[model samples]
Target chain A: MIAASFGAGGMNMLDSQSRDLIVGHGSHRYKVDVHWGRLDPGRVPVKDCHEMAVDSQGRIVLLTNHIRNNIIIYSKKGKLLQSWGTEYPGAHGLTLMNEGGEDMLYITDTERHEVIKTTIDGRVLMVLPYPAEVDAYEDASQYLPTETAIAANGDIYIADGYGQQCILHYNARGELLNAFGGKGIEEDKFENAHGICIDTRSGKPELLITARQQNKLKRFSPEGKWLANIDLPGAYICRPVIKGEHVYLATIWSGDGAENTGFISILDKNNRLISAPGGNQPIYHQGNLSPMYQQLQLFKHPHDVCIDEDENLYVAQWNAGHLYPFKLIRI
Target chain B: MKAKHRGHSSILFLQKIALAVCSIVALWGCSTNKTFSQENDIRLSAPIPQYSSTLFEDSFCLSFAPGYPNSHIHFTTDGNMPSRKSAIFTGKQCFTQSIHLKAISFHPHLQASEMVEIDFLQVKRLEKVKAISLLQEPSDSYPGGGASSLFDLQKGSLNFREKAWMGFDEKVVEIQLEFEKPQKLSQLSLSTLQDHGSWIFLPEKMEVISQDGSVLSQWPIPQLAEAKRLAYLHVSLDEIETQSLRIRITNADVIPDWHPGAGHRPWLFIDEVILK
Candidate 1:
């Protein structure tokens, strides 16, 4: 194991392979390794390891609410390469987008109530403030964007999950193009529009947004038309990560009221649950998929999933102590 | 111009009073458990009870991880909530028969944690139960291991979504348990999950009846209505010898009006049923 290093002091490396717990179901099974990113809490503390993404260079980037080092970059072998960012106190979401040839990151800070586009090395390129141009936002605090999806044409779609619960669309230059998907109980509206992604599974890029509180994944047109909904009862899922023909999600919670209950769900091109990594085997009764829950205690409140090129899953959790990310080696 | 200036000054005075009153009301709202100060709002997690074996041969020692360092734990044996004034847990206590242990953790600034209950039963010369038939089956989502779950000699944790819980929705559950021979039953108790915000509530009532449809004994399960991690309901029955028994539990049916999901069907979750 590499010697663990933090801000100034060195800490002992953690070895969690002794647990030897095997988790998941079907072809997506994995052996768990919980000590992948353990850090010294005094020097580099983490409140919530919220979201993670793998850049084109195959480096794993993690985002946490801890202001000391909000962004942590790790090698594929679970070695800490570097860490940066102290301006984001509520760094909740991280999305990596490639523009032209270089990788750019869009970070949504709930405390800042803004979406920031930055170079991979922590240089702020652009910042998108609350859409004061829209009538829904009375002030900046009412626009806590949680996640963003970038289009191929360089447009940004922001999900105001913790605030007015709407989606704000913006052009590349931080100009408002259109804003839709406000808070409501209808199919087009949302309760917690936590995450969004551009789906290219059908070759025609569409919007796959997570209505987290409603436990459904909604597909919308580029112009914000409600197309279809893939209902996952009892699964309050987070963002959708598309890897090739399959879609993966880190279900943040299940059961009720944001308890420490979660699982990793994998869906096929048809949007049907093919496997659940930490939950029971997905069983469909009649035409509805049975409510799924965590069977093994492998995860608690999994906020995001980052799958490397080797198909291994790195799970970032929330409210599960100050523990580090858990790596699931694909079997 | 002087009269108009006075009028504007009076309006400004009235606005100041309104703002003061609003701030007071907001502060009062925050004081009533709806919100708490960060210093005093430290998490007092429920105690995790560990046993040598939930189904032990004779007697078993009960041990658990402390909720926090230097915290005191008080527990009870009669299925009541534990308070700071309750008996402190010194070490392992030897018990002759079955018992229900309810514990609470206390810290300096943190609020007392909700009670955590663990039940231990001692099997003796009682007849073996054969099968159990339900009038209405539980939800397909949580079938709970079918008939074997009742006396499987296992317990569930705070996470009721595990396979240990038998969950039912929208309907009451009536069960008929058949025994191989007549046996004496003096006590019956079970654990249920109570998370009002999650639409899982405690049972409304519990009743025991004979195989001939005569009411044997009945008791009302108290409705805490608040968020509790777990609830253990134990009712002492007069010693009765019976070949079979019928158990009936009334469901919450609808979420209470105070809850967010008012008028909607709530869930009923029961894990293990212990008898002696």
Candidate 2:
């Protein structure tokens, strides 16, 4: 394994803009590893480094839309392991699941409007196409899948965040079970529902989804019943990542104008944001989260974050000059 | 044997020089876009210039305070991106008539900040407001400073949520501003924000009327065939006399079919209403 230490000599390799800086606060503070993943673009080009996931073998898997190598796997030490796949042109989301003792992956492609199930080595398992049965969608172009969540029973929940603000449920066999939520003015409706995840934190399985444009997270029953709404006044969160009793998020953008201001947030069991990795301290006035923004410009459009077994974070960004992921080693 | 050993040493020296050159090039490439440390972040928007409510004189001189230390501020009044060649604010500036001053701060190694624009209008101040009312209230998110915001003589930035612009969604805005006494008005103008992609559009039409139900002037806001930048719409009325000014601004109603929010309700944002 490559050494994780950045001794005195290695400091000279960092850019003058970011030589030695620490971000985050409280229990989530981190020391940045800027040179964690440096690959020659000519050899392995990446467009938008959208999302990341860690496999059971501890290999950090990154999903980019770059057709040459859609999936780039790296070691915990930031060494390149292997990369494969070129069929997915608009690879946006990646979800790694361990099924029957084997690691599997679900990739959502917005360009083709479909959800693909593949093995760790790029073998196609099942393809969940657009929902033709839904009356709201007369054709396939109206459904753009952005994310997915797997249930304990192998049910797959797909979030159509780009084209339509809704969630599609499919059983283990890839059969559509139900579709709910849409663009509306109702309290339970969504506006740019970008990410979704199955939450089992409260002892019962439920759904936690991101209403990105509205800056809120909506919780629903496994059957798609609206349970509650968590308001994050100014944060446009990408996805809800559950690790143990804490929930992590990569805020893609913030501010009233939706500028390219982004940061990482950590919430406690009750869903109260207690820590922001690169932003202001979480302050609540009468139970409402005041506007939050990037206190340290450490992240620009942080689309998703993958936490390893060591609790280190790998942050993938979007539209940030084609840079690779940044490693945040927990302090 | 001596000559052969000397030749081998010379070749080794040349190889060492080539290795040093390659290492320098590699280090330079790595420094191009390294991840930023927290302390080197680009500062937020430049501080807005502080000025008076109205200019009573024909021409006025203004000054600016530095927003970020160790930074150079470039300013422009023609609605263009300020460059290094632009006017570097030394201390103050002088202006005649009305001008929109947009400025940005630039630090050496940090990123440039977003532009901050403020408008200074040279108009006569009214004695007092008799009464004011709005036919339709603005959206709760951007009620602005309320009816008083229209006369605050301050322009809104591209960011309309700065508590300066009153935003109306799919709704017409009818405002009546009564002066302390009847005054002869020759010109009337208002500014609206046009960020089409964000679902904000210029008002379709504007009508100015008098308390006696006489139409002073009416004009249609022209839609830009192609809008690639954040834009503003300023419409002025001809000479007219009125006691109470009744202004009506019609919204675009629905976004154009070519827009991403084609079927959604478009927003109308108005920052300052200038009456001369």
Candidate 3:
């Protein structure tokens, strides 16, 4: 176990000169630097820093609900490079995709009940409104999209997590192709389908949707068929970020959904929990992962995690005193 | 003159080194003190109790959250604050009667967490209850297994979406309980939930009236500064004998101004009603 050497005072002095606090276990350990993304709140204020993505330029882009500046761009070294977008008041999810040499972003706004496709520089490219075509939705109010995942073929998958609890699949031209997984306790259904990501680790694209409240990730075929479930036990994972042979998730809650008990979960290529940063060490007995809980107060409510090329992690939080993201330098 | 200048410069360099050492010592001292203070603020997470229901019959097995290495969970059944000397919870405990269970988690290097308390009522099953009816229907969103749920020995969690809680948004709710014969009743308890974050509040008052139109007991719930989890409100009756009883629950007309749902009608959720 890592010793609890640093305290609240050490965190406050987390500039370049302070000693590093190492967290996590095994090969996934990181040097925690809480002030890596600090910005002057007056000049670039944020509220509920929801999610983040890495652009083609390697610059970290943050999506927040604050209308003053919805998207804040920062360099890998934590320097503020640019900020834009006043339109996304409920910007909750961000997915950056490099389409044939052009970097595009898909922003899901819950308040607008729409998934917007925009250029990296904040210009609107396409808008996919509420899927009124779905029989479960009566109006646009019942379809609050929280996250979006784009497949390699430009197919879009949106998770209506805060609303009807369904996953809407669309083609490249924003045409609805299929919608499935409504609210239920069934294997194919979802409770809080908060996030979605296309997993191509097996060399074939499959949808990994977050059944967050159930503490499991429901895998589905591209056509919205049940594939399998990756049970995370006590981790209320927000989304799955597949990089290389690992799956990184920002667990928003741990241990019966307690408040302010968020952590980061890392899974091996076989979907087994290997490490949990800010949480108890992952243990498995006879192939069943033990229930995990917060072991440290390193995070409040981690909403999303962005991994850079150097394997460093940028964690954005939700309702965590409106603080900026914390950078976890891989050790 | 050159040698004297060199001597002065050497003295200045020594002073600078001494100042750096002093600053480092001061910073280290400050960091150590902050670590101690922060360690004092580190609280163990409250242990969650696992039970089918708070209302149980005969003996029920109650277990708590799994313990961590070097940490202990102490508990008491007599309503007192749990201390280090309290009974250590190893596994499921069997209880035969109503108890106010309070538990606390303690670690050698961290502060003890706040007490997590619950009142588990040992109900008699009320075999004499002939029928139960509600004057006004509960909200469709939360029917809570119908009016019979009041005596069904089911308990609701903090989540209102659970089917065990009967939620009402109206200003008042009336329930009638018919008995096979006149039975002596001394105490009446109602298990309710209060989650102001979800606009669910405890009732303002509750009245138990006899079949003869006389008020047997009345309880005015005190307004709380903040929301709490599940609560068990008890009212002492005057050992009244009646063939039937009427339960009148008055909901809070408006949420307090301090709440986010101020001026809006608050919901009232009740799960179990025990007559002893």
Candidate 4:
């Protein structure tokens, strides 16, 4: 596996089959994720980050849980860039894309019960308010969007993380294509699909989705197939980001507030843990630190992550208002 | 000679004084028709500025006047945020007809505010509630799946728990709800663990029995593919009201290949059975 680094510069054509590590770290200052999700043990609650996306500029975007209104941006060096959006009272997962020639943001507000698309500047571009056909919800605060994945055609895959709890498919133009994925525990099905990724790990583009509660990763063809389910571990194993030969994920081990400590695990193509990213660090478990001796250099509650051509890591931290970015070097 | 010089100078001074008086009179007379008037101070206290309510086609527009003509007024319906567009005042209704004028005030930066707020509006049909789920159960039954629950709540009476239904082979769940009267239902919504379609289910058995243990109706045999998992079910609430209606489904079929026979045991999840 390539060694990991935290900063700057290089250009080498890399293959999609290369090995890489997803490093992680958490801080005590910028944990604006929730009341219990602060950095210090007196405040921060437990929240593992989930579903992340990389911008064209190589920045990372993160979405936190336990009372949405969580969003954070960061540079490759893990510097907190700009962060806003504590509006999703019931927020779950988040994804980013380019719309009007810029890194556009799409967030699923499970509480407000709507899907919002905005510019990086936080201007509301389009609001695909609650869809009508899905038998989702009629109440204002019931439509919960857990995660979102983009298709090449701009179609959006919305994981109904909470509320109606289903996978909703929409066209790039924000039209309802088809709505699937609901409450179940099956190989071809999902119990709680907390994470989703549309990757080309296969020769062709396919949907590499993770069912958090099921501890399984299922890949589907673009048309939505029950292709296969790979195994993963942890109680609340969340969204999966498919890198070269490995798939990265976040798993929650403790509390429910911002201070809750989480672990990040990497799985090979066969879905086996290569190494746990934040598993070695001191997690703020119930006031004192939960002593994990692994000493992973930099990570905590890695809810979501992404890899670029340069092997840089862009992670969206859980309970953090900002994203932490690192790079996998020649270690 | 002295007298003549004094007279000429005095005459010139008097002429200058007369011209100044004439100009002053002209300025004073120009203020008559202008009332600071046209009720420029007339302002509205309702129908907030940026608020929008699509409750009606031709909604009522609350307006104000007698105040600043175009001094920049701002308001909110959904609170704090005004609509994107800016509207000018004809002094009669600068906002829209639908705004309840819940609250209005001159934008603070524009100087003063003669604010007005209307009481909660009678929002004739303010919002339309399409469906309401009666079941709200959370499930972590599947390993390696998601945090999403097995089913959502809806306007039904049969919840999976009350129906003795969990899940089945191919992970398909058969749902059946019973009521007292016959209801015309054109559509039925069922949510699988990771899916959201297919209403008709293969039945090993479909029988509706009354509280007296009498069979009210026996569902016909059918062939429907086994579903991924049963999430939520939706059927119209337009019929009978049997306090206790038993819906039995067993020996289910997975695919809609052959007609579903009364063979294998099927799952029965009745979330909310509503009878009209």
Candidate 5:
């Protein structure tokens, strides 16, 4: 496996402002296998990027919370392929659905208070409204969704992301099947329950959620049973990807510091610690101040991580607005 | 013989160099995205709190603490941390005038506050709390409600669907409140952006809860009606003395009598819940 970047060797890869990713790069000769950071020089050239989803064909889709305009799609890398939805003024959540390399992309627009499905080519396939349980009607704010997860039977799990902080489940037809989660510090209680992913770590369709404020990773059954509470130290936990048997998690930083160091950590299925490769330190920028002039080898925030078929790992960073790709090669 | 041996040695040397280059190339730029085999050489600490700040009662309240400088302080007087920053906390001199209060300092380590309550009489909402927009107003869907729905097409609700549908219509939607005491109710207005349907299902009973399950106040709404537009209710507090008050919508109207949206569903549109 390989972690690819714009280029190698800190050679001012981008014309815009640069952000460096600091992973554990051992010395050259003794390093039988090591990982290095390459600068992705191209600017994303978008207004605001909040949520992202990659289709089976490796197409990148994103939801922005900026204006009514939402849901932008791009190529596998940093290339801006195309854009759509001046209609979704309050778009925030998105996910790709179906089996057999399906081209369907599902989106949630808080502004319009609706979940929509379309082709990867960007045509409105179907319009799914809120489930009967959520007061999206009469309470427009309740319709405001933050994130989305797809079920095997084409059912959609919409995290009433911002509206009511609840998990609203809908059949593939956009029918509200069941709903779970509320605003609380309790087990299934969500405090800005931001991001979610479907996990089979428990050998079932378990809903894995990142409750932002509570600072925990919570797993729930499809019928909404409290499975486990993932304990971590950071205040904000961003997006999570449950790969095979491991989870690579980091921070959602608005500032710099090793505290919010944005370290990439590996945790097992039961929500216990597997390990944090570089402790909790991620790659960071060194501000002139020098402990022997060491550039920060920690992270600001590692927003999203994806594992390709080859087990190559790609991470999306929020603050730096950079995409860091790395290969998981065991030496 | 010497030349052949020399050539073999040189070729072997080049082969060695090639191996070194490949090893370096493979080793170079490896990602630390996975877990570290051993604990990395690092230490994790909290954001240093000892920094000065400014509370722009209307614009922005910034805390100058070290570490995670990007951490936004999303707080509320109703003891709710809804969004990153969605609380409507009112301070003295905060209504219409822009109140600029010097941001106090943070002690870095404690993550505690030297300043908790920003004088309410001096703080106000940066933007006006939106009013109840009835599908029409200078409305977002001003053309008409029938023309295009306001909320979600993936129609579902927490109250009437899950909470009410699961048991009875008892789970209360946590609205805002007076953290210290009650305020004015004259300019009280309600605007809703409909997601799917508009129907406030109320039971034959009403129970008021104040920190306990005991009824603090009780009222009964004996009917269920088809709300043409968003539902609106207003209560005026004389001196504003209620604390942690909950108004649970108890009456329910289900389609199948088992689950909601079983046959067909209605909608309620709301854009904002403004109580001035």
Candidate 6:
């Protein structure tokens, strides 16, 4: 790493370098590094890097829609390790779960309207097709799953964000258990339910679903009953990635829903926003969050953020000129 | 004494030359690190503007996005392009008359951003209108307050999902406005939005007809480059006197082939209609 002093004369030189750019608010500052995961586009092309996750061996695995190579694995120090898979034309979401001391992957393909379970090395374990058991879906074409959350008991919860806007629950054997939450503006219904994850911070596993277009995160019981709602005005959040006591999300758009306005949002244990990396400082007045907007042009259309064991952040973008993931080294 | 003074003056001149050389070397080092390619890659984004409405009766407050360190926002009110020498916007400004505003952002080490322009119109209240009704209804998804929305004097943002915009997918839309008596009118302005990402476009053609079904005036919109923003189309009426008028709007039958939604029906959105 190159470090330079920003004296009276060399201010312009230090301003242009990305290594010296530190972002985020109090207690969560980070130094941005744009050249962390850059690779040759001709050899390994990427089209809309959607999501990322870290495996058991501490490898960063990224998912893209490019049919050439859908999954690209990298080391923590920005080295290309391996790549695999080509069948997922619409590979949107990637979820990693440790089962029986082995890491398993859940890939959601929007074009195929299904979810597939695979081992870390790209071996298919099981496939869950469209939920014909649900009455809201007339056929398989109406169920376009975007994300999935696996429970401790091997149960699966899928969010059909593009199609019927319903959350489908299934057992470990790929059998449908319960389905709820259709498309509407009501408190129980959802609008653009793009992501889902299980939050265990409260000692009980509750479903946290992303209502992206409405800029809200809804909480539901394990049996699909509405619990509460967290309102984030002007933030079009994508997914909920839970760490030890905080929740990190990638906001796709903010401030009047304009294009190419994105930021990273971090919430504390009490579910209140604490820091926003590329946005304004989080301010609350009488237990309500003020509207948030992009203050710095650091990211465009950020889709997901993966936090490593050291609390560093890896951000993946969509429709940002096919750029690679940017790394935020914790300061 | 003269020789000693000359020697001291020469020493001072030499020291000034050395300092000048050092300053030049420092500037050259900074230039080498900041290449032209790198400057082009990280251009600053245009500032986002906020206002209560584009059409106001008396006045409105215009504000910009939040600020950051080492960046400045400059603006102009006469429709000229904004430059670094323009007025710096410190906070929200109140305007009392119609004006065309343009703004741009600049940073220390990055290229300047493109200009953002908006037009705010000062309108007069019309009390001669009696009843207004829509002959053709809008889409079910975007009702937008029904027929009263056209005369509500409110404007919608770029997000078409907002309730102020009335979206129509039909080929032809007709609206009837009846006055208590015949009134003289010279111009008509309609506020619309064009957000290609959401598949919303402006109307193709507009016509004003008298009570006898005779065309009084017409305006045909010309095809232009694709842009995502709001617009105001002004139509000249020639000061014709009429009690009842029918305003007809035509939508594009098929979207252009270059768009993502090619060969599909284009949506037309209108928020408010004004008569002067």
The runs of at least 3 residues in candidate 3 whose Cα sits more than 4 Å from the true structure, single-residue gaps closed, are: A1-43, A75-80, A132-139, A163-166, A177-186, A254-261, A278-281, A291-301, A320-323, A327-331, B1-42, B212-227
Query: Which whole-number lDDT from 0 to 100 does residue A135 have in model 4?
Result: 74
Q: What DockQ do you compute for every candidate structure?
A: 0.02, 0.09, 0.08, 0.01, 0.02, 0.11
True-vs-predicted CA distance for residue A156, candidate 2, Å = 0.3
Q: What stretches of model 6 exceed 4 Å from their correct place?
A: A1-19, A40-43, A77-79, B1-45, B109-114, B130-143, B168-176, B196-205, B210-227, B248-267
The C-alpha RMSD of each candidate to the native structure, in angstroms, is 20.4, 10.8, 6.4, 27.1, 19.5, 8.4
Tell me, by DockQ, which candidate is best.
6
lDDT of 1 by residue, A1-331 (tens): 0011111101121221222344566778776667777777787778899999998889999999998999999898778888899999979989999899899999999999899999999999999988898888899989889999999999999999989888888889988888899999999999899989999989899999999988899999989999999988878899999998888899988644347668899998889898887666677788678876654345778999989998989999987877788887776
Q: What DockQ would candidate 3 receive versus the native complex?
A: 0.08
Q: Per-model C-alpha lDDT, please?
A: 0.76, 0.76, 0.83, 0.46, 0.45, 0.82
Fnat for each predicted structure, in order: 0.00, 0.14, 0.00, 0.00, 0.00, 0.11
Candidate 1 off by > 4 Å: A1-19, B1-276
TM-score of chain B of 5: 0.24
Tell me the tens digit of each residue's lDDT in model 4 across A174-282: 8888876567775666776766778776568878777765556778776666687765533245677776877766664322111224555566565555555444333
lDDT of 4 by residue, B72-184 (tens): 44545543323213243334443334242322334211222223332222222212222222222223331211111212222111112222233333332222334234333
Give me the displacement of residue A268 in model 2, in angstroms.
1.3
lDDT of 3 by residue, B1-276 (tens): 999999999999999997887678644333332221233344455666788888787877889756544667888887667777789988888888888777777765555655667778777888899989999999999999999888888898756778898999999899999999998998888888876657887777788888645553344433444434678767677788899998888887888877767889989999888899
Model 5 residue runs over 4 Å out of place are: A1-44, A58-89, A130-137, A254-261, A277-298, A319-331, B1-24, B27-276
Docking class of 5: incorrect
lDDT, candidate 3, A1-331, per-residue tens: 0011111222232223322344677889876667788999999999999999999999999999999999999999789999999999889989999999999999999998889999999999999998888899999989889999999889999999999998998999999999999999999999899999999999988999999999999999999999999999999999999889999999998876766778999999999999888787798999999898876667889999999998989999998988999888786
Residue A264 alpha-carbon offset, candidate 5, angstroms: 3.6
Best by TM-score: 3
Please, what are the lDDT tens digits per residue for candidate 6 over residues A1-331? 0011111222343355432445788888776668878998897888999999999999999999998888999998778898888999989989999999999999999988889999988899998999887888888899888899999999999999888999999998888899999999987688999999999999999999999999999999989999999999988999999989999999999888887789999999989999988887899999999998887668999999999998989999988989999988776
Model 2, B102-173: lDDT tens digits are 666665544555565555667755557687788889999889888877776566655666677788985578
Q: Residue A72's C-alpha lDDT in candidate 2?
A: 98
